[model samples]
Target: MIVRPRPNWFRMLFVWRGSVLPVILPQLIGTTAFAILVTVLHGRVFAWKIPLNFVPFSLIGLTLAIFLGFRNSTSYARYWEARTLWGTLLNETRALVRQALTLADAPSDVPTLTARLIAFVHALRHQLRTTDAKADLERLLAPQDCARVQAARYKPAMLLLMAGEWLADRRRAGQVPPALVQAMEVPLGRLTEALGGCERIAGTPIPFTYSVIIHRTIYLYCVLLPFGLVDAIGPMTPVIVAFIAYTFFALEALSAEIEEPFGTEPNDLALDAMSAMIEATLREMMGEAQPQQPSGLPPGGFIQS
Candidate 1:
């Protein structure tokens, strides 16, 4: 995600980083040019003066704005929900690792379990982003576990299964009380639920038909708006159309960027930074030095991944 200090109102108008203006600039320019052409023609085609006026456009623009608002709300809901799931995952992992350390009779196994939990976070990050997690798994997991996880189709789920098995083994050996085991299982179940939630958001997107309709409507309105206004507004038609086009096009572009919160887009969630945070917290709990920073993340916690 784009992390920087917020600028004042005056500077905010020109701020480019994390803004969708870059993506929609071309569309805005095209709309402006179309508007200019329509203005030059004065709503005439083949010597025919089309009896168009701004009244119809006013109604269409109002309705289009409402639809765009709804679309943006839907996209932001997905983004916010993804962030909430990750937050829950963070809390659950911390709780599970803490329980394993304090409650287990075989405290020696705490380090290994904590390492697996860390590995699970990285694996889940990679899974949601559709990237390879073999290197991360190898670094954070034992050779046997790492190899097994690498071979599995769903590495995160496999890691969770291993965690459950570890707890089960302890229960069988009478190393931990049944009550403690049950408590530990609670966080594990929560972790599973968070994973499923992320998967659901990643796998399913806002319906394509909504995007198609909104896209068509926004462009159609922008392209035809000049003809409606040229007679009334004269030479200023392109300028007015471009201003209006910016608002509609920018919102559309922004909604597209944030709809998939796991993506590498600048405005998407900072999964790499979050994974690093989980690692740091777990390592601290284990009384170990902080792990080296991951490649994509820079110093001072600016996440580009």
Candidate 2:
């Protein structure tokens, strides 16, 4: 995600780093060229003139804008949910580490336990992004523990299971009282729920047919738009059509970018930064010094959303 102070109104118009303009620029240019061609042709096909008018385009534009709005809302819902899950992860991991430090009878084991927790956070991010977690796991876990988690197909779930086992071992050995063990399990269970939620979002995507229909509709509407407006606006068709096409094209592109929320896209959640944050927060709780870096989100406007 692009993280910086919001620019002033005039500069915002020219800002490109976090906007969908970069991805849709080609589409916008192509549509504008098509508009220019249609305007020059006077909306003609060889010897015959295409019968198209502004009234139908005006009506269609309104409905198409509404559909685009609805689709964007749906995509934003997924993006927001994914962020909420990660936020829960940060909170629960902090809570669990605090509990382990104060409640566990064996103080020396706290650091090791914290390492496993950190590893789990990194593992979840890698799992969601479909990246390798071997380096992170090796850094945070022992040879045996790392090997065990690496061998599992689902690294995050495997790490979560190990955490539950850690709590169980402490309870059985009389190092952690039964009541305290039950209390610690609350955060662990919340962590598990967050894990499950991330998995659900990663595995499920917006319906393919729905996206296809909307995408097809937007392009079709834009392509035929100039033909309808050339007679009404004359030479101004390309300019008007370019502006209108930009709106529709940008919206569709933005929706598609955020629909999967776990990607490496500019709008996707800052998983790498967030994972580092969890690590830094946990280390601080364990009396380790860590300098936290900023991983701020973009503005809430639809253009950036």
Candidate 3:
């Protein structure tokens, strides 16, 4: 996600990064051209003047804005929830690592499990984004664990199961106390819940039919807009229609971009940065030096992946 400090008012007006302008530019230009054509025709074709007025457009525009507002709100809600889940994941991972360090008697085993926890975070990030996690898993896990995770259909879930098994084995050997194991299980369960929540958001998007309806309505309104304004606004109709079209089209595009917060879009959640933060935090907790090059923040202080 684009992570630069907020720009000033002037810069904000011209800023391109993280704006929906790129995606909606073609549609806006087409709408503007249509508006210009309609205006040049004086809202007439073949000596037939279209019987349209601003009254209907004004009323419909109000309702369309409301609908767009509601849709944007819904999409933002999903984005916020996904970020909350990742925040929870980060916290729970740190908690799990701390618990293992303080409670487990096997010092060597603690590092292995901590590494697994780190691997689990990366795996979940890659899974949510549908990217390859083999390299990350290989780096973070032992050969056997890496092989098992790679072979599994769901790498994050598989890693979690392996962690549980390790705890159970430790408990069986009388290394980890029963109460500590139970304590550790709490975060593990929370991790699972977080993973499931992410999957739900990624899997179930805004309804397809609802999006189509909004899309069609917006385009219809924009295309018919110049005709409605030509009688009153004359040559100004194209400019007004284009402005209005930009607002609606940009809103629609923005909603679509943010609706799936796991993506690599400029406005999407910073999963790469988040995962890196989690890894750095966990590794620090384990008394390890930070990696020379962390993966979270890109060169421009943004997280793209």
lDDT of 2 by residue, 244-298 (tens): 9998898999999999998989888778777877888888888888745554533
TM-scores of the models, in the order given? 0.94, 0.94, 0.94
List, residue by residue over 1-305, the lDDT tens digit for candidate 3.
88666788998999987888999999989999999999999999888999899999989999998999999999999999999999888889888888888878886788888888899999998999999999999899999999999999899999899889989999998999999999999999999999999999999999987699899999999988888899999999989998999999999998999999999998898887878778887888889986643543654232432
Clashing pairs in model 3, backbone N/Cα/C closer than 3 A? 1-303
lDDT, residue 61, model 1: 93
Question: What does candidate 1's lDDT look like per residue over 1-305, in tens digits?
Answer: 87556788999999887898889989998999988988898888788888889999999999999999999999999999999998887899989888888878988878878888899999999999999998898889889999999999988999999989888988999888999998999999999999899999999999999999999999999988988999999999999999999999999999999999999998999898889988988898889999776665656443432
A best-first ranking of the candidates according to their lDDT comes to: 1, 3, 2
Q: How accurate is candidate 3 locally (lDDT)?
A: 0.88
* Model 3: worst 10 consecutive residues (lDDT sum): 296-305
The whole-model lDDT of each prediction reads 0.89, 0.87, 0.88
Better of 1 and 2 by TM-score: 2
What TM-score would candidate 2 get against the native? 0.94
Cα error, residue 235 of model 2, in Å, equals: 1.1
Of the two candidates 1 and 3, the one with more favorable lDDT, higher being better, is 1
Q: Residue 127 lDDT in model 3?
A: 92
Candidate with the greatest lDDT versus the true structure: 1
Q: How many residue pairs clash in each candidate?
A: 0, 0, 1
